[model samples]
Target: MRVEDAPEAWEVVSSTERFKGRVFDVVTDGVRMPGDEVADRDYVRHVGAVAVVALDADDRVLMIRQYRHPVRRLLWELPAGLRDVEGEPLAETAARELAEEAGHRAATWHTLVDLLTSPGMTDERIRVFLARDLTPIPEEENGFVPRHEEIGMPVEWVPLPDAVEHALMGMIHNAPAVAGILAAYAASVEGFTGLRPADAPEA
Candidate 1:
């Protein structure tokens, strides 16, 4: 059936916060199914996030290799961060993350894609921005010193096609990285006219 015509199969009867953390909140929902069955579901509520696919003069994409403890590996990923700051514009968040994680700034920005990181589990949305006209920020010139995940993150500029190959070969597992690289590659094939304005509403 088409989603627009699909019935509302599950109605939330009640919801309570099960846990609250700095990054996200877990809520337990008591839901009523269409067949009169009731069940409890737990999922995470998040503040959303942004990722940057910063393409440079020679057509290389800025990338970072960072240690993800849960995954127990240093995974290659696009510069990204949570939209934890209340009321921060999404474009600003993308720009901030690009500089913070990759130590670069972009003069041109476009909305590459909007992603739901894991739709079945969390309400985490990520806006992936295509950044161009790149300029580097010296370590001493950056506003905040890198820490935690950003500290010593391995930064690199990989050719855009190489990044897409890495993703297709299962060498790049980060969701945003895979999607951003592929999407950016596709945009290039289309002459980049498909990209939306950075401030445009999520599609």
Candidate 2:
């Protein structure tokens, strides 16, 4: 289906800063009907951001355990975040998020894909990257709030195969993490045509 074909119009109604200091903007959008009638709709405009799947020399994936308030569940997933600030490019954002969320940095960066988290209602896009050539950097050096607020985050290295299995089995609930890990494996394996190494383009 063509996304542009969807009939919608948006106008900025107002914007406000929440208690957490996060800016929340309300948008008035119009939805077209079968008879060319339009119904105004309202939604929010959130700054987009990135996610990174960092791998170490042991072929183990770097992951963090954290709590998600929306689902009311703890999740095991790749390092990710929203643009803590506006006007940040996705590649740099991905690198920064990896360091902040996982307390790690990559010497090399490769963009795997750009994905739409929710295209129907929100303007959120997640650029997923594959990071290797890692060097452990301190969380303080990264200048990020640790993954958890009251408690500390446990960063674990899960073997890639096991991570993939867990993802398929629904144990790893982070969509970006699952997608990133599978894409990374495809790039490394000879038979995975859907993904090619970041250093090389698909044939």
Candidate 3:
């Protein structure tokens, strides 16, 4: 039997907004099940996001540490941001995030992986990109100013193998970061021949 995730959606009998937040909204959906039962499902509605697995000339993956209030732990993560800009390309979002958060720009980019983060609880999807041939953006040219949780965020470079180990050892808890790290390593092994174009449509 062929194993693949095919797109399918059960009938939504009704949907109501439970709460609205700046970044995402909570909605309760009454969905019709196979047994003709209507089940109420509460899930978060998100605008999606993009992340970058930036690899430097020395094969080091750029990382950032920020305090996530809900988890209450300063976790290491890739440079990522929301797809909040209307009609903006996903790759552009990833590049913007890399420049703003990590102060670097990539000469080459490719789609690494796409994730349905917590599909059971949210429709938050993220696309991770593989970036290489990086050049630092001059301090004066970087116009983005960090604020709130972004302020004082520290950026670091870790070898790809070490990043994979950290992800497997449960040191890196960010879902996108873990997924990007493993996917990048796997692609690296094959000389990144399996990667798609940065502008490839999401699967």
Clashes of each: 0, 1, 0
- What TM-score does structure 1 among the candidates reach? 0.92
What is the RMSD, in Å, between candidate 3 and the native fold over all Cα?
Answer: 0.8
Cα lDDT listed for each candidate: 0.90, 0.72, 0.97
Residue-by-residue lDDT tens digits, candidate 1, 58-135: 889999999999989999999999998898899999988888888889999999988888977897999999999999
The candidate scoring highest on TM-score is 3
What's the TM-score of every candidate structure? Answer: 0.92, 0.76, 0.98
Off by over 4 Å in 3: none
Model 2 lDDT, residue 56, Cα: 89
**1-203, model 2: which lDDT tens digit per residue?**
76543445444344443223263355665656566676765555777667888888877899888888879988887888777666656667777777777778788777776667666666666777888889989645766654344158778999989888999898897878888888878776853345434444211
Q: Per-residue lDDT for 157-178 in model 3, tens only?
A: 9999999999999999999999
Clashing pairs in 3: none
Candidates sorted by lDDT, descending order?
Answer: 3, 1, 2
lDDT of 1: 0.90
lDDT of 3 at 33: 95
